[model samples]
Target: RAFSLNYWAINLGFAISSAGAGFIAEYSYLAGFLGEALMTLVCAVLVFLKVPESRPEQAAVKTVGGKRPKDEVRLTTVLRDGRFMGVVGLSFLVSLIFQQGYVGLPVAMGADGLSSSDFGTAIAVNGVLIVVLQIPVTRFIQDRDPRRLLIISSLLAGYGFGLTAFAGSVAAYALTVCVWTLAEIVNAPTQTGIVVQLSPA
Candidate 1:
């Protein structure tokens, strides 16, 4: 539920910004860039005002019980954790497909004779879908097996993102984005939960 709400809010912001960006860019890229900068500043201000500091209230100390407790979990310890390493490796693979959403998708669409506006609208579908489906989907999958969720997410992400190669029109590309966005919603929280479990407490 934590992860679901986090991403739900993020995608809501993305959906609004992405669609608005298209119209803004159509007039002036300068204006688009300025708008992005302004939004960033607004976010910073909001965080400063609303978010409490996470730092512990205790006074700073060089050691706990005369020992470096933080350093107890060493890099070597994490590297030697095979299960954690394996999951991280798999996450890297999934990220490769996701990276294409912002990187290769636009380039490929452009090569197929689509305009910048078309790409914007198509990619916006990704954010919109996440906003709509994340909570409901997370509710359904929250207690299910992580292994099964991961497997299904990987397949859905692979198939949906891979289908973009065959997408010729904006609608077709948007459809492909929807497929992968569902995968994204599933994979994100599931993968994050797995990593948290594997992490050294």
Candidate 2:
């Protein structure tokens, strides 16, 4: 959920920065880069000032001898868990797919000859879809099996990306993005919830 929130903030910043870039295009690519830099700096400042540490209060407590609470199990013991290894592998694969989308989409859009306005509109559409649908989708799935949702999300994202590979028009690309956004809606919350549930006691 925190990851989702950070992703949301960055996307929000991107939308604002992209609008700034559209206006600053009269200047140069340097102007747009500077605008993005400014936005990133602002986000960094806000996070530093406003975000609180989430570490457990118990972690700050000391024993009578002044030693902090010690781990009962060794790192090697935890590392021996098969489920932990599976989770790590799944996490790596998911992260790879997620980052690849970010890097690959712009290249695909540029190749398809999308204008600035069209690209912006498509992204805005994606944001809007998430904002409107995410809550209802969460409510609908709250009582259902999360693993099933995760599998479905993977299929949706795969199909979405496959469609994007052949997209020729702005509308077609937007449609493709919409499919992936829905997948993300399902993907993000379910994975996060699972991670929290699976954490060692």
For model 2, residues 23-107, the per-residue Cα lDDT tens digits are 4654576877876698789989998899998876654444658764565445765677678667767867876675545567667
Q: Which candidate is the best by lDDT?
A: 1
Q: Each candidate: what lDDT?
A: 0.90, 0.71
TM-score for all models, in order of appearance: 0.89, 0.77
lDDT of 1 by residue, 38-117 (tens): 98999999999999999769655578788876656788889988999999999999999888899999899989998778
Give the clashing pairs for model 2: none
Q: Which numbered prediction scores highest in TM-score against the true structure?
A: 1
C-alpha lDDT (0 to 100) for residue 129 of candidate 1:
91
Estimate the lDDT of model 1. 0.90
Report the Cα lDDT for residue 27, model 1: 85
